[model samples]
Every structure is written in structure tokens, then in C-alpha cells.
Target chain A: MTTEFATRHLRRIRLVLWGVVTAVLLATGGALMMRSYLLPPTSEGISVEVATIGETDIRSEFTLMDHTGRAVTEADFTGRWQLVFFGFTHCPDICPTTLAYMASVLDLLGPDAERVVPLFITVDPARDTVPVMAEYVAAFHPRLVGLTGTEAQVAEAARNFRIWYERMDDENAPDGHMMAHAGHMYLMRPDGRFDDVFQEQDQSPQKMAGQVLARIQESQDVK
Target chain B: MRVLIVAALAVMLPLAAHAEVVVTDPWARASILASRPGAAYVTAESDEDDRLIGASTPIADRVMIHAIETDANGIGRMVHRKTLDLPAGEAVDFAPGGMHLMLMGLSEKLVEGTTFPLTLHFEAAGEVTVNVPVLGVAASRLDEGSK
Candidate 1:
């Protein structure tokens, strides 16, 4: 072959390779720009994308007995927002205090309380029987519902909620034992999806109510 | 003679310094269906500094002092308190969500409307007994504030 023809072929191959590299670089830059747009950098300079990528929606369902000994399930919590707490009636401090605080929050919501249901699910089912729950709940808000089921049923509900609770046996305890459980309140959406969780300790009723109402309003805006 | 006088003064000093522990609005939550644990709250004050070492009630097998606190995991748990400081001229309130006298193993049901005897033991004030009215389970410090 002639030297001129060989040089022309080599230049053409080099030009084609350069074009491919430029196109690949432009495509990658565009994709990264789109991702940055979707997830803005938080104050910590870390995009929420990394956090959301590993997060899976929590869909939990369980059948339990209410204080009245009536059978209820997750379906019963439909059509309204549910604020569920896991605790026992014998819980001298946190349980009643949390209930009272939640009641105050619901009261502050006023008529809006109708749209929310406060639930107290006992982690110590062995002691918190139906009658015990009935009296225990009546002491709190009228809108509060106390639920206690069999050991297996309670365990299933706790598992679905992904909460940790263990019966701490104290020989000196008045009830013969105590249940050490998570103290966060779970806020569930009308469609039975996990919405938000609130820590009851040291949090005022008004602030918690504001957070809950804001979330509900945000959810409504999305719809 | 000076030694005798000092000895007498020493004996009378405790009685002279026996600051009165005033317990007001003393109340307790009525027991629910079964005889479970209950808590009693009171506003205590003294003319001089005193420490509430312990509390007791005839209705319970034993009375305990407990404070509700959030642990490292942010979970609320009850911690037994050995003593509560009460400064002079300042009222210390044992209210819900804070410190309270836990009545364990009630001898009788703390029914609403009934009154039970609660004795408060202080370091310098000796023992002061008060009748704690049993209010409904929903009663709290705010409820007493209205009255």
C-alpha cells in the first residue's frame, strides 16, 4: 500500500477513537448532574441518596386483641393516622406519662384528634390482661386504645414494628418483673405505611403535636 | 458546768433544728383492676434544708422512690432514687414524669376517693405523716393546680 494512504487510514482511526471518548465523558457528566439534582446535598455534605438507597419501606401487619377482648388487626387502623406505643400497664412512669403527653397533644389538635388514633400495645402480655388493659387505658385519654394479645401475637406485632423488648426479670420488682422495650412512638399513615417515629422522653406535647401535624400536612400535600 | 450545758444543748439541738417538712397536695393514683404498682406525688417544703430519705405507706408492702429517666438509648426507664434533696424555702414537687413514691405490692386497692396514710422520712426533720387522697388515674399536677 502507498505511505499516504496508510497515514490517512491511521488518522481516521484516531479521530473515531477521540469521538467515542468525548461522547462517553459527556454522557457520564449528564447522568451525574441529574443525580445531584434529584438529591441535594444535606448540611453534612452527604446526599440523601446514599441513605435512601438502603432504606426499604416497612409494611407490617398483625392481629391482636383490644382491651375489650375484641379481635383487631392492622385493617382496623385504616382510614386514619395511628400513633402506636409499645408498653405495659404496669409501667409506672413512662407508659402513663407518654399516654398523658399523647393525650395532651391530641387535645391540642382538638377536632383533628378524630383523625388520629392512639394505641398502647403491651409488651408484657403475660401480666397486662384484657381487664388490666381496660382499666389502664381508661386512665389515659378516652381516645386511647389498649391492646394486649397472646405472647405469640405480641411478639409478632413487635417484630413487625422492628422494636426490641425484653422481659427484665427483677425479683425485687413489684410486678415480679419488668419489660425493657423501645420508647419511641410510631406514627402510621392512613394507608398503613410507616410514616414517622417520635421519642416521648423529654419531648413536650406541643412540639410532638406540631411535628405530627406537619408530617400529616406534608403527606396530604403529596397526595 | 459548761460541759453539762453543752451536752444538754446538743440533745436539744436536734429538736430545735427539727425543721417541719410541709407536705401539701399529697395524692396518689388509684389502682386499676388488679393490685399493681402505683405512684404518689406531693409538694414538700421545709423551713430548713432537709433530705427526703424515704417514704412509706401502710397500704403497700413497700414504698420506693423512683425517677423516670431516659437511658443512653433514649428509652424511658425507672431509676430507683435513694434520696431527694429539698432546699429550704423552696418547694420540691414529686410530680408525674419526674420523681415519685412508688408503692409496690399494695395491701389494699388504692380506690378513688379513699385516703391512705403516707409517711415521709427526712434526714433532719424526722418523720411527717400525711393523708394522701386517691385520685383517678388521670389526675396529675395540673389537676391539683386548678384547685
Candidate 2:
């Protein structure tokens, strides 16, 4: 009788231990999943996830004046891949750096670059006139096209692309004001659909060119 | 002998203060246009805690210390800083995306492959002048061959 009682006690303890262990494991796994979901996307972690593409409703519809003072729209850039960047020429550091990167990416694309149209849309339309943009884009790549428009047109374009920009007055600034704007580069498909968005931290020209070429090839294969 | 010792102390005092801080890798991005501001970067190391009070260059009318702060969405805003603190035994880097010297009202466009003198003023180190090399507009760091 005592032997049977001890065996039953041992079995009860073993069952309780197993339940505790399983509960601990489940809690730990749940905590890890929650942490990942709550954490903000880091530069290194988020750029690799191609699945996140198109999750945001980004469009390429805009009516603006080209650097040559020609009126144009999204339809004007149809049948060609567009790399769109929104910035002001007055910006000294980030805008120029990103434009230089875009120029390098184009150089890396070489002949295939002809299929791509790199657009620089100004956020500060008040200061970035057609001639200013013409001179600014000329300093970067020969093929780079600069675009500027009226405040309402620029605002509509920025809203379509989900770009945020604000002008802050500064006494020391050249124009007595400075603009803060998003720095992401948008790669639009030939069909005017958003293909990918390059973050400011992605400064690799070679990698960008490779990705662009791969996408182009993929689209061609589909056709 | 006493007169010689006094003269030696006077010369050595300034030298000692200057030797406490070392500035290197001074460089600036070539300005794409004369109407726009230019940016310059340098690495500074100090033996004792010091503050970078001001900076100046003959090429620009004003040299303002600025820092680029990025929000969670990766939007960058340029903030003007009156001074920068350099802690003891720590190297403060003024790089492309972080802290930089904003050269405002430039006399002329900063052409590539050129050099200019940048004078930095420190609370303890006094005024130190570094010959800054102008790199390409998109250059993030000094090239391997160029100093």
C-alpha cells in the first residue's frame, strides 16, 4: 500500500513539474513575440525585409514644372523607371549627399540607366525656382531632372507620395528659413506603381544598382 | 638663469595648452553652388574636458556649428549649436550626418581638389587652425590616399 502511495505521489510531482516548464516556455515565447511587434524598425533590420514593400499607400501622381520650365505630370514619365527624390536645393548636407548617391547608382547602372529617370522634386518651391533647380541638378548628374511647381502643386505631389516637409524660420539661414523633409528615395516601376523605397541609411550605390537591375530584369521576364 | 626660466615657462604654458587638444581629418564637401551653405567635418580629441566655442574660415562669412537630428521616421532636421562639449579622453567626430560646421555665406563655391584653412576655437586649447581638404560633394569620409 505504501509503495503504491509513494508511486502516486511521484507521478503527481512529475506532472506538476512538466506543467510549470511548459508554462514558462510559453510565457517566454509570448514575451519575445510581443517585443518584436512593439519595437520600432531599425535601419538594418527593416531594409532587408522586402515583404514590407507596398505596405504603405505611396503613389507617383504629380503635376509640376521640369527644370527646363516644361509642364509635366506622372504620365510624362511613363514607360520608364523613375527614381524620385524630394528635397530642396538650399539643403546643404542630406539633399546633396542623397543626390550624389543617386548619381553614383545611375553610373553603376551604365547603359541600363537609360531606362531610369531620376527626378528631384523640390519641397521649397518658394526658393527653389526652375533656374535654381536647373543649376542644382546640373552639379550632380547630367541626366538628373529637377522639378519645381507652385506651392499647391508641390503640396499635392508631396501628399500623394506621403512626404512630410516643414519650413522653420531661422535668422541665420541664407533665406531666413530652413526646410525639414523626408529623405527616402522612391523607386517607381515603369507602370507608375511603387516598386521600392530606399531609406537614407542605405548608402550603398553598388547594392542599389544591383537591386534596380534585378527588378528591371524581373519585370522584363514577366513581360 | 631666473630670466631664462621665466621665458621658458611663458612659451611652454601656451604649448602645453595647445598640446592638450589634437584635431585631425579636417575636410569639407565641395559646395555645388555659391548660394548654398557648405559643410565641414573634423575629429577632435582632448586630454582635458573642453568646449568648442567657435569656428571660422575665410572662405565663409560665418561658420556655425550644426547637428543633424533624425526623427523616428528618419526625417533629418538641422539644428544650430552654439558650442560642442568634448569630454576628456573622448574623440568627438564631426561627420557627414551628425555634427558639422555649417559654412554660411561662402565667398565662392568650394571647388573639389582644393584646400582651405579652418580655425577652431576651444575654451582650453585656444585657437587651432587646420588645413581642410575639399572632397567631392558626396564624399562621406576622407579617401584612402588623401589626408
Candidate 3:
């Protein structure tokens, strides 16, 4: 009789233990679902994490001539946000594709785009002259500015921006040469400070515009 | 009689296989500058395994198949490919920022709304020419609306 009583007591204890374990699991699962539901939506597969200037040694300083044959420096664009891209007109694929993407980004920004200046700086200054830059930039967007300077000037600008470019010889190319350059775009603040960098993979127009708009809003908030 | 019939079937089979390869949606990005090279993309499908050996066009001095490869640091470099395999029953796409036909020494600017002829040479299919439409300077696809 005593053994029967002990077995019955043991079964009751085991049932209570299982009940506690199931309650814990259910609570954890509910919390996870709530966390996912509360999180902000992300763009497709892109991460919305903003990379600030503190992480990199990027600076905004350049002395180059605009497509209109006017000499300008970073100081001229101190009051406006800058979107910079480095490429050559001889580039058949990536350059044109990227320029088009920039144009779309500007369009998506609408009136807010007025506060942004998109600059296309040529890494191959030897072939990309003022006239070439003018016609090329005009084809994409009227507001888009093409910058080219002397070899040393362009090199200095590239160095300040931490851009790496090299001329590769191709016997079959149009000019018997081609240029390979870093395909990243830079976003700078109105105060002429580096703000963020967008890699080639993050070329979505909506996502890019949203990121830029967020920065613009954040700057205003600080003011 | 049986041997003669078998030889005739052998010759007809290769010809039928060659006829199965089809190229569609051939288009080229309009050259922003006439002095710069142009890029063209197309979709090729084959019923039998074949190889894209070469391509040619009267508008360009040299036509080369090129691919853009990005390094770990996101630097893009163009690599020339001698040949590309087209496996049976699969479609191969040559598009922007990917495999493309580099049209070197363009005779004239590729104007929008215009079409040019591009001849593709295959290892088994011989030569096939398709009229390629010229899209906008920044056009990614033929159906993409004006931006």
C-alpha cells in the first residue's frame, strides 16, 4: 500500500514538471513572434544599417573642372549634399548602368533631390575631356555634373576619396585601353563631410532614396 | 539498304539539333558617345548542348564576349571569355553587369528605336543572325519604360 502511494505521487510530480517545460517553451515562442512583428521592415535582402564616417578615413576634398569647363572645388558644394561616383565614359556596362541608377534615385527623391548634387568624376582623365563629359552627363540627367581634371588633380581627388583605379591594356578596345575602378558611390553631408558609402550591390532606387532621405531628415532634426 | 538509311539518319539528326538553338530578345544599349564601345545582351536557348564560340556585326570592328567580375573589395573588372557553354534545355542570358557582347570600334552611335543585325556563331549551330534593337542609354531591359 505504501509503494502504490509513492508511485502515484511520483506520477503527479512528473506531470507538473512537463507542464512547466511546455509553459516555458510557449512563452519563448510567443516572444520571438512578437519581436519579429515589431521590427521594422527591410528592403528585399538589403540591410538598412548605415555606415557612418567614423568607421572609415573618407574625406571630401577635390579640385576638378566641371563639365561646363568651370573650375570648382569642394567648397562650392559645401551647402548641398553630394553624391559622388567615379567612372570613365569608355566603360560600356557598369558606368552607364550606375549613372542610370543615379538618375532614378534623383527622380525618386523629387523636390528633395534639389538639395543633392550628383557628381560623376572620371578616373580616366586622359580620354574624358570637358566636351566628352558634357555630352555624356547630359544624356543621363541635366543636373548630373561630370568632373575631369589634370592627371595629378584627378589622382589627388581619387586619393582623398580612397578610390582605386588602374588602366588595363586591351588591344581590341576602342582606345586600346580600359579602366577598372571601385564601383562604390559616396554620400556626403551638406557640411562637406563623408556620411555614407553605397556598394554596387545596393543599387535599388527606392532603397537608395529612402536612405538619403533619412539622412536629410536626421540633419534637419539636429538643427 | 539498311546501312544507307542509317547514314542518312545520322546526318539528319545533327541538322535537327542545330535547328533547335534559338536566340531571342537581342538588344544593345545605345552608346552615349560614339567613340566609346557599346554593349549588347541576348538570350540563347538550345535543345542540344552547344557552345557560343564567337559573334560579329558589321557596325563594330570587333565583337568580343566579356564578363564583369567583382572582387572582394567591390572593384569591377572585365574579363574576356573565349567561349560560353549552352547546356541542353537551358536558357543563357547575357545582360548588363554580367556577360555581354562588347562592340569595339562602333561605326556609328547606336540610336534609340533603331535596330541592327548581330550574328552569333555557335559550335554546333553554325551562324545565326538576329536584329537587335537599340534601347536608351541607361536601358536595362527592352520592356522597361522610359525613365
lDDT of each: 0.73, 0.79, 0.80
Q: Which tens-of-lDDT digit does each residue in A72-176 have in candidate 1?
A: 998988989999888776666556666777778889877778899888888777778898888888877778899988879988887777765655433323322
Candidate 1 per-residue lDDT, tens place, B1-147, comes to: 999999999999978766888989888877765566788888999999999998888888778787655657545455667788889999998887677788877888888888999999999998999998888665656474235
Give model 1's share of reference contacts.
0.31
> What is residue A187's positional error in candidate 3, in angstroms?
1.0
Candidate 3 wrong stretches, greater than 4 Å: A1-55, A172-182, A199-203, B1-19, B71-74, B145-147
- The sequence of per-residue lDDT tens digits that candidate 2 reaches over residues A140-178 is 999999999997999888888777665543432322223
Could you give the CAPRI-style class of model 2?
A: acceptable
DockQ of predicted candidate 1: 0.14
Task: Indicate whether candidate 1 or candidate 2 has the larger lDDT.
Answer: 2
Q: Worst lDDT window (10 residues) for model 3 chain A? A: A43-52
Per-residue lDDT over A49-83 for candidate 3, one digit per residue giving the tens place of the 0 to 100 score: 11122326677789999999999999989899999
What pairs collide in candidate 2?
Answer: none
Candidate 2 chain A, poorest ten consecutive residues by summed lDDT: A43-52
- What is the TM-score (0 to 1) of candidate 2? 0.76
Q: 2 or 3: which has the higher DockQ? A: 3
Name the 10 consecutive residues with the lowest summed lDDT in model 2 chain B. Answer: B138-147
lDDT, candidate 1, at A196: 80
